[model samples]
Target chain A: MAIPTGPMDLVYRVLDDQLVDVEGQRCGRADDIEFDGGLGERPLLHAILSGSGTWHRRLPRPLRSVGARVFGTGLVGADVIQVPWDEVDDIGSVIRLKARARDLGLGQGDRRRAETVARLPDS
Target chain B: MKKVLQLALGIIAAIGGFVDIGELVFNAQAGAFFRYRLLWAVVVGVIGIVVFAEMTGRVAAVSGRPVFDTVRMRMGLTVGLVTLIASLVINLITLAAEVGGVAVVLNLLFDLNQSTLILLAVMGLVVIVYFVPFDGIERIFGYMGCALLVYVVAAVHLRPEWHQVAQGVVPSWHPSALYAYFVVGVIGAALVPYEVYFYSSGAIEDSWGVKDLNLNRANAALGFSLGGILSIALIMVSAEVFAPAQIDPGFLGTTALGAQRAFGETGLLLALLGMLFAVGGAAVECAFSGAYTLAQFAGWEWGKYRRPREAPRFTLAWMIFFALAFVVVETGVDPVLLTEYAVIFSVVALPLTYLPVLLMASDRTFMGDHVNGVLGNVIGWAFFVVILVVSLAAIPLMIITQGGSG
Candidate 1:
């Protein structure tokens, strides 16, 4: 696929799309997009930010902090995952990353819970 | 021949898995009170579910995203958050009701205490979730739910006037609040949001791809139609037995008596067994749907295809939902009443639940050439209007009728 040269091309194609790791496992969605330039200069896609923290940022200003707290992202101090644009291998129905979610530290909760599950007694 | 057998089993499982605690008593009560007057609502609901389920399956098969995933992406964060909160609340209520229904069924069967049965029901569900593979879960509950076919046989044995039954299928409206309430409840229960959440997610869990599009169509069309038939049969049986007696079949036990009245002891046992599995299956569906919605929206690893350690958060979400539902059930509320509330509240979430699926299914970007056809669009939008009106009116009607008491 041709690389998207303009912001319009990437707007719907990348923004809000579900993120899939190298193994095709769901990591999350592009809850917010980071642009490289401050303003006026040709803005370039920097990274795809995901997780409840990013989701909370999208809320209205009054609700943002409260939403984060209620969703437990703020309470737990969960950081938003940022995947650099270069790591995105393909942009299709889902945003496919070239790296594993674990390698990117995108699935920290899953990794943490996996350890707890590992210690549970077998039925 | 093997392919044909597989198709038949799929259809049977759909039929068996279709009715849950809400449908079981609500359809029965519809028949007992209004005879076949509410049959048209079931038809409307079945068709609505067929259209939506087919589209969701196609989207999942082709686009590889489940319903809630599309829901969150298409609606954006603010609207998506509202939908997510609504869906989770509805899911919890429905899950609690189904768990409660299971306890009631077990209590009736074993003559055990209801509170004790509720605890056992939660434990049994937890154990099943821990051990059963996704496919095994479907087959076990799906097949056992087939015992509900006793209602169909019982309906046939009653041998009602065929012409009258046919006439009932034609759309008719009643000004009575009670009638309108039942109509909304039946349709709402049929198109309950969790079914699509579970169905579309199941498509992904089963690893459906473009090659499975035909299978998806067959499953949605045939599976939901079969379920619709069972629902109608439940109404018919109740109409034949309870309508004449002027008895409202409020409890699960009362509904089973329709079968017993027709075929004696054997039919009653089959009906109760069918209720157990069907409601039990619904509890599992609700639990999984709750987890799937949360995990999918939050972008966590999810699916029964993964081991507990692999999808620990997903597993934890469902386990927590089951425990919460058990607590709700232990409050000594009537499970039947809870089912009614769940169905009504579910109607409120219908538009939010379905609008995203409809939009995604119609989008060429997502579905490619498989985008909804003209017929699908007409039916889809038409049902959207009906669902919107019902959503607005559901709560008011519930209050006015006191949950159809009048």
Candidate 2:
């Protein structure tokens, strides 16, 4: 696939896309996107943000609290995990990363829950 | 032969999986009250679901995004959050209704304690979800649920006027508010959002790729159309057996009587067995739908394809939903009544649930050359408009009809 050059359509292409690790394991979503630049300069993509509470903040004012209440904050002691844009391997149906989930501190909740689920018979 | 069997099984599963507690009772009520007049609404609603399901299934196959994932992406955070919450609440109510419905069937078959039956129902559901593979679950429930085809045969045996049944294919408006409510209800019940959510996610669960696109279309078209035929058969049976006598098919048992009147004890047994599997399938579907919506929206690792340990949150979500539904059922609420309310609320959520699927299906960025063709767009938009109108008109109709009391 040709690398997307120039401005990328973050909203349509990247934001809300599924995050898959280098090993092709499912991890999380691109809950939010971060950018960095000075006022007069074009902002460069910084990182992708994820975790339970991160996306809720993007909800409108009235629904923000409701989102937070429903989705909760910092599930499994991780409020948010960020992957620098440089680490992004490719963007397609899913946002692929160059690093494994644990390396990027993603999927912490899933790993934690998996341990408990593993103890169950035939799980 | 293997391909043929797979397609046949897929269609059979869709046919049997289509009618839930809501469709079973609602179609019967419509038939008992208005006889064959409301059959057009079933056709309309079934067509709508076919279009919607096909679009969602296609999107999942081509793009690997399920309905809830599309819900968040297209609608954005604010509206998506609202949609998620609304769908989750409605799905919970639906789950409760299905669990309670299973208990209702069990109670009719054997004189068991309602609470104990409800518990047994959830336990049965838990065991199935834990032990059965996805295809096995579909086959067990889908094939068993086909026992409901008894109604089709019974409807024919009862032998209503062929001309009258034909007339039902053309939509006609009746002056009564009760008539309008039933119209809205039959359509709403047919277009329940869980079907699409389950379908799209199931596409992903089955690991459907572009190669499965034709199969997806076949499944949606053939499966749901046959399912619609079952709904029509239900109406025909109820119209023949209950309409003339002025018997209201308000309860699940009442709905089965249409079969009993035609074939005696054998018919009754088939009806109950079918209801058990169909409603049981729905309970499982509803539970998985809730899990899919939450996990997909939140971007959690989810799918029955994953082991319970592999997709822990997803596993827990469905299990929690079943436990919560059991709690709801324990409160002694009427499952049939709950079915009515769930249908009504589900229709209200229909537009939110469907619009994203339509948008994403048509978007070239997501779907590439596989984006909905012109015919798909026309039917998709037309049904979208119909569901929106029905959503707006649903509450008032329910109120005016006093939940179809009149």
Candidate 3:
């Protein structure tokens, strides 16, 4: 997958978009985006952070810590599910990644739950 | 001819699936109190839902995103969190109410114990959800839900003054708080947020794409408009039957009594069957909507199309909702009253749920050639303002009217 190179609005376009792995399987969402630069310099997109805990980055300063303390570790106990910027293949309706969900260490909870659900009759 | 048959089936199913527990009771209650005066509010609601559902369905078809995805993306973490929590709470209560309603209708038909029927209803629903295909669920519920058309038939049989019924189409003001409360209830019940969640997610469940846009439009327009007509028929029947006798059709059974008076046992059976499926359909939709919103917001795999094993967490999510609703309904609260509260409170979540859809639908960058045209934008924003005002007014109106008792 060739990467599309250009400046893009990370806040609006990237964050909160659904994350799909190479097999077109949904893993998670871009809960928070990491940037490489700081201060007055141009910030380059570094990584996409997902999981319930990582999403509070968009909240106000006071509420952020409270939310982090409450649900800092996501449901599957992952502090954060991070996918590096280079793994991204494209960004359209969903953020397409060039790797499998397991390889990216994402969607762990659903996979675990899937095992239990598969034990049921219809599932 | 085949395409037209498909379109006809979709529209008919939509019409059948439109009325739920909230509209049934609320419309009947409104008619009993205000006669045909509240018909215009139902029209307002129909137009509002038509605009929003069409937009959200188009968004799903063209962009492959459902309502919750739009909610989290547009509103961000804080507001999205708020909307999710609020919607989940309301959906749970509504689910409980619908489950309770199904049980109540069953008890009426079979003369069985309510608690046992509640358990049976839940078990049956679990079985249906587990085994039936998504479209099968829609058609079974939607087609059987057409039994609610008996209200329309009963309304005509009662021979209400056509002029008075016509006058109800024009909004009239009453200087009573209870009247204001019923108007809000009528409109709020019509635009329940779960409908859109179920709708957009249903679009994705059916694998709709850009070519399905015409079907989406037909479903939203004709389906909901006809559903609005059913609601109006409920009001007219209530006005003609219960109002003159000073009877409040408060219970789910009492609402059916209106039909029974028109056509005896057959009408009663049809009304009860309609309520069972309509309310039963709502219970299923609420469970799925709860799961869909949570999964989409949290970025988990979700949908019935993926099968229970494939979408495990999504399956677990809806099953949890079902379990929770069972516990709630088992508490012996009045199902009709519970639905009334659900309808009134759901209004508060409308603005948060709808604003993102309107924003996403109109964005040329995201929607590409499918962005909302001038007419869609105008109507969308117009209804947005109406929703905002009603959201602010809902709680106060509930308090002042004592939940529409007086």
Ranked candidates (DockQ, high to low)? 3, 2, 1
TM-score of model 3 relative to the true fold? 0.96
Per-residue error for B315 in candidate 1, Å, reads: 0.8
Per-candidate clash tally:
0, 0, 0
Could you report the DockQ of all the candidates, in the order they appear? 0.65, 0.76, 0.80
Candidate 2 regions exceeding 4 Å error are A65-77, B8-17
CAPRI tier for the interface of model 1: medium
Using TM-score, give the best candidate's number. Answer: 2
iRMSD, per candidate, in listed order: 1.9, 1.1, 1.1
lDDT tens per residue, model 1, B1-406: 5444334323433543358887888889999998888889988988888888888889998998899988887888888888888889888888898899888889888999888999999999889877888877877777778788899889899998788898899999888999999988888877888888988898888788999888888888877887888899999999999999999888888888988999999998999998898888888888999999999888888999988888899999999999999988888878888878888998898898799899998999778898888988898999899999988989999999998888
For residues A1-123, could you state the per-residue lDDT of candidate 3 as single tens digits?
234467667888888899999987888999887789879999887888888877556677888878878758444337687789999998888899999999999898889999999998977
B391: Cα error in model 3, Å: 1.3
Name the Cα RMSD for model 1.
2.2
Residues B98-160 of candidate 3 have per-residue lDDT tens digits of: 899889999999999999999999999989988988878887777678888999999999999
Reference-based lDDT, each prediction: 0.84, 0.86, 0.86
Rank order (by TM-score, best first): 2, 3, 1
